[model samples]
Target chain A: MMNQTKFEELCASFALGALDDNEKQELLRELEESRPEQLETLKSYMDTAEHLPAGVEQTDPPEHIRAAIFKEIGAAPATEQQQDEATPPRQIAPPAWIRAAAVFLAAVCLVLLYFTLNLNSERIELAETVEQQRFEILDLRDRVQVAERYLEIIGSRNTYLVSMDGLEPSPSGFGRVFYDPESRAAILQVANLPASPPDKDYQLWVIREGTPVSAGLFSLDVDDQKRYFVLEDFFEEDFEGVDAVAITLEPEGGVPQPTGDMFLLGSPS
Target chain B: MFILFALLKKLTGDAQEEAELLIAVAGKDQQALGRLYDLYKRLLFSLCVSILKDRHEAEELLQEIFVQVWQKAAAYNPEKGTAYTWLVSLTRNRAIDRIRSKSWKNQQITDSDPDNKILELIPTEGSNPLHVTVAKQRSTMIQQFLNKIPDEQRSVLTAAYFEGFSQSEIADQTGLPLGTVKSRMRQGLLKLKEMLSGKEDQI
Candidate 1:
């Protein structure tokens, strides 16, 4: 007889389905003659071994695999036929009152269907209206934010406003630059500028000492009803010396250097 | 005592339902076969994929196993084991057999490294919440138990149970001695049984 330790070892392997043929036979013999407690222990081991796959994610086989399998086994059509045979036959020749009731129900169904179709169209229209209103609200919120910042800059005691004279590109154009020394915040508002060319943009540059730093690039909507194009977030960095602010018409995506004609220039007084 | 009785009743009820289905399947009731296929397909498919590491082959084997279930339902003996255990064992055995075949061996060589392959095949999407919760809880409990065992022993146990690797095969794959693999598997199972028995005592 195998020792208890060796027998348990074989049982564990047997539970794991890892024992070879010889060891399997030996384990089978032991299991056949084992006491109840020993059998329970082996069963527990098998139970735990079975649960090892519980950690693995459960995946459904492809939906058609079931159908394919049924087809292969010639069971799909047979099941359908069995189901049909098992179903009771439909009733025919209803009474007069029942026919009248059926006609009334059909009329009610038609009315409900008509209302449902109408309600669906109305709901779609309502959804479109809501979406449009949401976009309008968002646009209004953005404009209000810009107006609030503009008012703050104009109202600040420390802010200095500099006016720019129209230059060669557009003599009728005018611009204003607002700077707050304390907050180092600036905003630019330009008016009456000619519409930029399709391939060109209006670039703002701030001269700090001698070298000019590019502020940003923008293009105006000539067709817009608003007269002033307010450029928020004009300059992020603080420049110490008070100098000139200039606008140049350059190719789309402003050049590193001012490679185009200056459209507006203003030097702080 | 009532709770114990209720639990036993539920288990027996489920087994009875399965037994009836199998009987119908044995009598060539195609609908009963389909019903049986739907009932166990997910669990069996997951087990097959974990061993085979290929969804296509796992699905093919799944169909073949169900066909066998249809043909061999009459051979099932309720006195020997529960229907769930019998079905799971049949799937695992067939999957292991397929992996041991010559063509499968050659395919394994051309495939990616076994270590990089997903050892546990969990679905990433669209699983039922209740099923997911239950699976998670069971998996977490199993992981906690596995954590108690030593690393080498745990690896051998996992290779044998999840990958269906035999003791000698685990030794070959891990480059460990066959005796070491055997000892580790035995120690791992003992530790798991002890832990589970402790839990049962608490309950």
Candidate 2:
């Protein structure tokens, strides 16, 4: 069986996409033998990977797409206008008050029903407004917590920051790795790196004894340039023997070692 | 056929209703399917177009998605993931499959520009606030979060995410060893999980 550390590493790959057949079998085995907490952690990673697409550019699909979907589902197209206002009830509850002489009163009931429908629609609108507010509150709370953790990490005395400078491929590229050996909390911030192609990724490496060990893989921020990434407990070991840190372009997910051009490299003073 | 109006008439007033809607659809309630479609069509379509980079293909894929949703709705468990995640994840997987297919490459000449930078995205208007809020805030938070992650981490995450590269594929494409690819994937995803886990996606 792989150790806990390796299992966690596999969780990341599992969250990203398909795994090689061997790795997939191993992961499936681990999942079967793992505890609930381990499963929860794995779930969290999957959730994060799934949510990552929220940042992509949003475009409205053409109207016919809706018609097409409905048809594919063996249904009529639900037009935008058809959904703008609630459709009249397919069958209003039997007009119980109706009698030959009570026609007028029944009409009154009909009008009352219309008003009630409108009121119900308004209620839905209000409910949506309330939901939006709740989301905002949750959002604010999340941001605050993230900020607090960030401050705590930065304030820790054990934390040290190292600077990496651009190399020939990206002379303007630069990066910083802030790590706290005690808490294993780490953050990486970088900018000005050339973008990787679709099938490639940037891999970070830690060099000790003139050999590079994989740090991680990353990409240039597609929307905004600066990237600030944090890991809760990233360090598997103290960097007592580490000599330098560097970044290189590699295959999409990343390689076990650096085989690409170095874009950024740094050494601790 | 799911009647949109009838579906609205059946609202349970639960604050976050996507899960409930999905459940209802699993029972073959046409109305629930209609409601779900109205709620997510735009967002899903946008994601589809972004990946396939062609509206025609995106739309075709999208139609197939809903059909699949109707057929496979029973397999979705709210406990496993949120309705939003389930839908988006499903769409992403399907879209990726299409883009990576041999047929797609055979007919395609243009490629996604490697040099192109993704611009800030604003969701198109008209989504119900209840449906739109979390996704909207998530969008903003995601953009902000993306800005804070390291470039190397972002690249690999994006490659797996947008380009749908498997770890082995990534290693093969970049000439890196499989072990390094796994490390990067692990590192990038762990940090992202930290960011997303702070708030429970309360419906």
Best by TM-score: 2
lDDT of 1 by residue, B1-203 (tens): 57645644555566667767777889987767766776778878988998899999999999888988887889776555556767877787788778777343343312243211211121223311111111223555666787878998988987887777888888888899887887888889888767755653222
| lDDT on C-alpha atoms for all candidate structures | 0.71, 0.71
Which segments of candidate 1 are over 4 A away from where they belong?
Answer: A28-36, A77-269, B1-5, B102-150, B194-203
What's the CA error at residue A31 for candidate 2, in Å?
2.2
Worst 10 residues of 1 chain A by lDDT: A83-92
Report the lDDT tens digits of candidate 1 across residue range A32-130: 566766766565566656656655667889877777778887865334345445422311457789989999999999999999999999999999999
DockQ each candidate and list the results. Answer: 0.21, 0.21
The TM-score each candidate achieves on chain A is 0.57, 0.51
Native interface contact recovery, all models: 0.57, 0.59
C-alpha RMSD in Å of predicted model 1 compared with the true structure:
26.5
lDDT of 2 by residue, B75-95 (tens): 877654467767887788788
Error of 1 at A33 (Å): 5.8
